[model samples]
Target: MSQKSLEEQIQQLDEQLSSSVEHQEREAKFAVEANERFARNIACFEKYYPQIATAISEYKVREDFCIHVTTTGVGNFVPKNHHAPIYGDDPISQVSAQVEYGIQHPTFSATDYTASPILEDDKRIHIRYMGALTKAFQEIQAEQKERLTVLPEHFPSAMIFGIGLGYHIDLLLEKTSFDYCFLIEPDFEVFFASLFCTDWFSIIEKVDERGGSLFFQLGADEQTFIQDLETLADDIGAFSVVRSFCYQHTPLPEIIELIQQWSSQYFRFQYGHGFFNDAITGLAHTVHLVEKNTPVLTLPKQKRVDLSTPIFIVGNGPSLDEAEEFIRENADKAIIFAAGTAIASLSKKGIDCDFHILVERPYYNYKVFGDFLPPEEYKKTNLIGLNTLYPDTTDRYKWSGVAGKGNEAGTFLLEVVSQTLNNKGIPLMPYCNPVVANTALSFAMFSGFKNIYLFGIDNGNLPTGEHHSKDSIYRNNLDDENEEGLVCMGMNGKYLPANFGGQVESNDLFMGAHFQLEKLIAHYPNRTVYNIGNGAKLKGAHPVRAEELLPLPEANRDINEQVEFLKSDFFEQFNLEEFDDTLLGVKAFNEICDHVLGLAKEPVSSVKEASDNLLRQARYVYAIRNTALHHLHHMIKGALLYYHCPMLSLLYTYTDEQFTLESYAKVNTLWQGYIIEMKEYYQHNYRTKCDHGKD
Candidate 1:
């Protein structure tokens, strides 16, 4: 009522007006920028090169880093171009429809196939399919070879998640060099088929061609994915990415345990029942985007290109002896890329590598590289490996992140290599064997060169038997090698390791190294490839003998205009920083939501639909509200391993831990609410179906 009080109210009103106006202005500006970036992102993938875009979405991106950069959609939650296989039925099937690729729980029944699998081991039909697979594998290599240069200048490797036959797989293997290959084939029938149809030798050679590796993929079903995880727990600490897909029908608690275990095991975990984000996140960050192409990272008036000497790749298959003459004659003319073990032999035989693509991942067998290297030459030679040891391995073992002590070595190896190369190896294409074909072809695409020459990349089952003749390690895993491990050569030696100790093959480098390589090459396809090894078969059963082909001179390939453009403006202009603000906002949003925890909670908007998609991130957020994630993982698993109504358990299953601190009671409350509702609905639905059947 006093004059002073009246003035105070007026002052407060004025402040509110200013703040509101400022906030609105900021919001409007943000909206415009967001739309622009989204448009650019789309254009980068669609107009410039659509396949590159799709491949990057699946092969090059990494979720933890790329999620913050941008979202698929801008105006609303829905995106304009839905990238990938989305399951939608006319009447809306919810999780039922989207779970097409889903693996069933171990105890679950299989869908009735009108035609059951033929148990008769018909040698004739099997041999014919084997012939077809072999031929298809070779031709695929040729096609990928011709298509390598089609990519824009960003990604450096290539990765194909699953095999639908050996078409895409063999294409990458024989064609070029990828940093690493990640292959995941969970089907038993296909696993056996690969044993005969696949020429895994070429995959090993291709991995050797580039400084990369190869690994396997496995998905978690309720029973098996977990059991397998535990079985492979000690060995799985070195994966690049642990990926899975599950639907609502899957036991929710089991899924949580699987994710937690994977994360703690020094692996990057990715999952999607039917979401594009899961795949894209892994591919985007794995890419090594260059300044010559992306406006996002481009600088003004960048020095375009400089013609450099042609580099020759030297592999260690039996085909090595075949290329001896050609390499010896042109020894002084070009750069030689020696595969892992081939280094020692070739270097001794007066065929020294100018740039060694050191792809070996094991501790014992990989040491052979040191024997070959002149220590002075080691510093000068381009020592390429997966992001396992660059800038050195000191940082990974110092208890970084949430990973346990068991995962220290694997994590360090990856961190070291990821930070190793500047941008020279920006675009590398892989020439993997049948085992790692996709990864090899992916690398060939990214290495910035238009022409890739592959030697000793013999994809045929090694002539001396299953093992590569050049390798002394007995390195590759012969059985699971075709299935769960895209994993390249393992550590071989007499010395036992200190931890579990003894001659155990390291599985850590399989997923992490190779997956990164595939993503790189998938985006950069200009540097296409051709296999010159005797066993580097393409187009038919017979290998393409490099001895028969005419060789090209080195001087002609030196002055490529593209390379110059890449080097000049790529560093200063291309600003990864521009996307940092956007990334921060995304991280904040995720922190509040909890990534994996959301899947375990009740959805407000649509329960059935949300359950089908089953978000993992939200569930992670929910879990963070309480006991350590490591401990809660086991607790949650024990409580919900079997099918108990989640809603019922949350309401009264009663964990002894304090529910108040972590909102456990609230979760229980909502979980029980869903169950009671579901019980009533099930009765109604049962009656309705019965009535319909009677009619």
Candidate 2:
């Protein structure tokens, strides 16, 4: 062999060895950096969100999921069982360009305001004026739509749909600051791969420093994603999500489903915005009832009742006519509950219920008993209702008991007062809202009835548009010219999945009640719930045909004795004099009013400033969440959103600096006036009424 050829061959071998060493060094450095990143992220999650921390700590890496480092030194995620990288050769530049494009064209731009003005003929000062103000601002927003070309530098809230390698999250955060950030990653493996590449610790620290929130919905699929979001919105102020800018990092099918679900049900946040009148009236009624020594429903502390007797929860739906025979035959064999206007239907059928439930707080509810049914019909039946129920309505019954309603200022105040006096507060009835059947179901559940059957509680109208029983007041109102027509504007164009395998027309109120019932049923997993008629298919309830009802053994126990036992088991009377000061909640109420008033009057220089001021108010309200006046947040949140959201839309849509400033000032002024009016009205009317009751 020639000496020159041998030397060349030797040189090539040495170069190969050097290249291998370089590759090993790079791999080692990458491993170290990944370990450091994982540790930091886990630590941050543990501090801020222990649930996420535990999930991440326990999650095992999928066999196919891995981090692929490109030649450009950027990490890309190779999703489950996929060989190809999620990002291209130059992932940094790819994600950078994508985020920049997303910034320019947000997937879900925050322009539309969800809160509709309450059109109820409420004569309260705030309700009357705020409704008019909201309508005016809504008009302004409609006019300024074309000008909403760019998002403000400081966005109020954001929803990041996916986190692939988390590059876009870093880029998005660097470009924009959000008060509330909801990061959702449907794939756990993808998120786990991201922990090695993304500096989540830094991101969390940055958000924390800004006094912002970061909600991580890890491993959430399309099925439960919106419900998760709803739970978060309930925990935080729902108003924060009113106009959130949504960014979809990875266009997955599940993410698309989530987006659609969110769009369809976003209006739910706008519902149940207890205005000042309702809040004050609820408080007054609650206070008056407690003072009258009305029996309150306490949570059951004993084991679940294993009675053979079934609970028949009756409602005035269209199916009532079909279930009449079933209810009549079973009435004597079960403890029957007549929900709301169902008493009229039951009276017509000559089937007396063991208990009659009422939920409405207004005088209209009190008039229902006097106007529709005579004293002989419901006088023998026991009354179970929310604390917000009209006091006079309970007077018609032989016996009555009230349970605390969730998400009401009156309930919160009563709870605090109860806690102050007895060291234990009242138990809030779960999902008792939007309808009377919900209250009846809640009562049945709390009473520990194992076998609860729903009759005529159809949460949707039939295909023929028959909503109520023939004997119901709803049908009676159609004939009586003096009775007002049904004001169901909210339910006019809605539909729901029917129990018997078809879609049925439903309203917002019924839909809400249906969902609430599902949630309540879920809380009692051991209990058996049967929906014995065609209705909106509830998630946790078993649908049964009226004719195919479960045949139970004849009830051996005396029905009257069982009814009295239930009353004694769940009901107690509170001494109002013991906690009169706490019951008023004047201090906390005034504090919240002061904070909101200041926020409304705060000066605004830019759209960002105006938005931030509104968010600041939300933070203030939510920060006092552990206090007795927390429900005040619920009371005012909807009304405040109705006022602020339209104003925000106008500000975001219109680029004219002077015009935006002027518009914000005008709206803010009107909002401030409303808050002031609310404070004064509550003090003069509700507070005075409570004080008088004490005297």
Which model scores highest in TM-score? Answer: 2
* TM-score of every candidate relative to the true structure: 0.34, 0.90
Which candidate has the highest lDDT of all?
2
Give all candidate RMSDs, comma-separated. 27.1, 4.2
Candidate 1, residues 1-695, lDDT tens digits: the string is: 99999999999999999977766665566466654544454453354346634543454222321111112211211111323222222212333232322322211111111122333343222223323333433333333222111221111223343332233455434343333244544432332223222344444455655545454443434334433443332232211122121112222343356444434432322110111111111112112221111222112243334324444555555556666778788766555556555565576566666444432222333343444455664553443333222212112121101110111222222222323432421222232311223333333233344555566544333333333434322244556544431234532321212111122122323333323333334445444455565342332112246567566665644433333343334422233322222211223333332323344454543322322222232234235323323222221221221111222112121122233113333443333343243233322221111111111
**Candidate 2 residue-wise lDDT, 1-695, digit = tens:** 99999999999999888877775676677778888988998998899889878888888875555566665655777777556678897888988998888778775445444255665666656567667676666666666544645556777678888888888888888888888888888888888888888999999999999888888887787557767887888778666676678888877777787777777777676556566667777877887788788988776555333465689899888887878887877677789999987887788888898898888876765764677777876678889989888876778888999999887877887787677667887888777887999899987887677889888888877765677787776633455567743422224668888788777687778878887888789888989999877777888889888888756677888777788788877788786753365546566667778888977777777777787787777677777776655766655665665666566555555667777778678777777887777766655566433221121
- What would the TM-score be for candidate 2 when compared with the true structure? 0.90
lDDT score, candidate 1: 0.34
